[model samples]
Target: MEGYGPAEIEKLLPAFRAGEAGEAKPPTPEQDLLGGPATTPENYTLQLSQAQAASPVHQDATHAPPFLIMHGTGDTMVPETQSVALHSQLVHLGRQSTLILIEGFGHGFLNPGNVTELGPGVRLDNGRLEREPHTGFTAQQSPENPFELEGLAADHEMIKQFFNLHLG
Candidate 1:
């Protein structure tokens, strides 16, 4: 989804907070998918409001259902803190939430090739987020790594268990 960058964000925050339409401003930077300074299409405020309207995080999550949020520590596209904050909000509001932060895993870390490289990630099943400080095989292997296969199996089982506990 196309979005505002740091510059546009600075401009939009005031209007959004006041619940007003965005002011007319020329596009600032080259358009990029990573939310970098980009050429914003016409009607910037309209887009911003639309995005906020569609975003779950921006809306009222009071009646939200259970959530299984899995994020990679190495993900550059979106910081791990975003997921953490979401999980925190959900739990604070007496909602069911689970967060798993896989270490050394970048974007699309759930792929078979994306095995733990730095170490074991943390899990927040209870209230507190606990880090699992343990090293494992890296994910940068030419041939399909055995560690990847093993990791995939373990992850699959975890998903199954979560589903069974919640759905069954």
Candidate 2:
């Protein structure tokens, strides 16, 4: 539901419609949000700008909901710069917004649970991810490793608190 529109959605639709297996995973750049390596620089910029325009970045203070952006620092698929832009724009527009860049985390690492655990197939040799006992989520970091924000209980708590404060 988050970005990864059209092309990605098409891939998911058949799987849901048939209630069966879906297309195999595409390359990360194609499968992830804003991962468009559009054929050319002009094309990429145009597509990206168009997509960004459709996001909260285009919304003025009068036209957007409160934003709480949580992103991982080590995400290779979608970079945090996108969120940073949105948050910066929101703040500049005098809108209520928050951006939390979870260190030792990567793109779409947000998970809600009591503990954060590395999912299967996480390559330990990469040194990008480490498990957290307290939260059971991967929250550790190495100076040379990338980060991914696993959906962790602590993340969930933050989400809950945000909702309570905003929706209460």
Candidate 3:
């Protein structure tokens, strides 16, 4: 995660996760990949400024609506702790908010489960053709399956119930 740029990060995506590498590899400077070239104080300031500008300003908690926050524990782009921090802040301000953490998932949870073919063929968001991973189950190893869909579905349902209780 530390030694990844936008391009390198893109390659780790689902579409490229299984694709064969091309002959020509793009040149990525070591400094660019690591925390050397873009880790200047000015870069940090710019990032902070951008985040502040993009963040929503909180209103008075007394009039705010209930909130449901879902965070993926394996999210490398944005740490799951950020959601926890926000949830804690809302609770501290006497607002109704619930945060659900989905384990073993990265930023993309729209498609869940072990890697499998979609059908005859299909194209992914990143333009590579492939099937998404199966939802609610892990992959089998040594002719033995370790994935449990029922448990994952139950956890997903619990999150739904929590949202319904607070938001409905």
Candidate 4:
């Protein structure tokens, strides 16, 4: 209740208390090893609290080491703002930090078979993002527009350079 908002605490407190009292059902054999649905109030609160505890944004960053943060502008899984916030925090604390946003790419772009789809607000062409409020598309890699493939190679080189500069 202390860590959560009034509305969320109202919903979660009942379930959390029920779970503490052993009113929640144990996992059945048919259920996955990870347990029940993610939306379950007890599990949701636990997971959210754990994630918050582990989040770097909430940690003390004073005198932290240099950082090279990279994120995809089109990523759907993790918001790019997290990287921006971390970088800003590091810079504000007087630590060296660089933030790079890869345009027209989604989460796991370095991995194979991950399709990059632009949302309605933007469009992707030749690894570049274009402003097209009504247009959205899936990226296609060709000889002329080998965005993801070239991006992976470039990212590897950038990582190598960062390590050489920071750790060498």
Candidate 5:
């Protein structure tokens, strides 16, 4: 949902009169929808057409289905703020929502070509991350840090737990 088929899609696309923010007036009809004002020209015309039907954020979240949001703070394709906004809205409406932000990951984090440091020279192997020892990365993957590849495993575990909790 951070970058795809969610109600907030219009906000991330370059379309005319595309979408709305929480309780926000849709962009003027002449403006094109954008992730934010920075995503496009300042003079583009836009609006959140059929916003209520397009994005769930426009609807009441008091009765929304359980939600588990996983986003990467380093995502360049879609900012983590979008997840932040949706989660905030759900909380504000007293709905069940959880947001897990993997700090150093990006939108394509799972891609083999988008790899990053796991522990100094260490990296994920066979679905696990190994430290190179005597490296600065050892400190980077500490338990308190949810920004490392290990955090991704924790995130997956949490997702599984979230589903079990909600589904049962």
Candidate 6:
């Protein structure tokens, strides 16, 4: 249960369900400013072809438990299209899933509006990222801030409700 296999995912399920884990750290300005390498159309096509070739299809027809797939709209690292594609596949397979796209959010939920003073030396920005001056967590722009984009918390809540209805 170390990699991206079923066993690993199963082992993490308890913490995930309890909402005690899965919180991703925010990208620093340096990390955010660095753009991806340029890709030509041909290279893109080739990558897509390779991915399609390696992709696996779920063949099981049995009903699956409800799923909540949330993706950040501003996620430059992982395109939102990936979540859309997964949601589409789930729907095609007659599974129950809900996809929530949070606007202004990036790969992580860290946003300026979500910042809150945690303690004397700790601060949490947008519930998506934490800042500890001693630990090198500095003030920076985050995708989790509602002021960065409207309805972020609401969207998150919607996803929460979806999980509650299906999983609970």
- TM-scores of the models, in the given order? 0.50, 0.50, 0.43, 0.50, 0.50, 0.41
Regions more than 4 Å wrong, model 2: 1-49, 111-154
Model 3 poorest 10 in a row by lDDT? 1-10
* Steric clash pairs (candidate 3): 112-135, 113-134
- Alpha-carbon lDDT of model 4: 0.45
Worst 10 residues of 6 by lDDT: 1-10
For residues 1-168, what per-residue lDDT tens digits would candidate 2 score against the true structure? 121112112221111122122335443433245443344445555555555455545545565666666656555445666666656676676666666665656533443333433354432112222243122322222232222334544355556666766688
Question: Which of the two, 1 or 5, has more lDDT?
Answer: 5
Instruction: Write down the lDDT of every candidate, Cα atoms only.
Output: 0.44, 0.45, 0.40, 0.45, 0.46, 0.39
Total clashing pairs in model 5? 10
lDDT of 5 by residue, 82-135 (tens): 677777777777666656666455554433443554444333222121221111
Clashes of 2: 20
- Candidate 1 per-residue C-alpha lDDT over 83-150 given as tens digits, one digit per residue, 9 for 90 to 100: 66666666677777666666654444444432334323432222111223232322222122112223
lDDT of 3 by residue, 1-168 (tens): 010012222222222212233323332322223332233455544544443343333334465555555555555654565566555656666666555554545553444455434233321122111132322322111122222224434244544554555557
What is the C-alpha lDDT profile of model 4 across 1-168, one tens digit per residue? 000011111122223333343546443211222244344566757655654555576678796766666556666445566666666666667766666666645555444342444444333232222222122322222122212223333355555666776688
- Reference-based TM-score, model 6: 0.41
Task: Give the C-alpha lDDT of model 3.
Answer: 0.40
Clashes of 6: 10
Q: What TM-score does model 5 achieve against the real structure?
A: 0.50
Rate residue 12 of model 2 by lDDT. Answer: 19
Judge candidate 6 against the unseen true structure and give its global Cα lDDT, from 0 to 1. 0.39
Misplaced by over 4 Å in model 6 are: 1-63, 110-156
Q: How large is the C-alpha RMSD of every model relative to the true structure?
A: 13.6, 11.8, 13.4, 12.9, 11.5, 16.2
Residue 140 deviation, candidate 2, in Å? 21
Give the Å shift of residue 2 in candidate 1.
Answer: 21
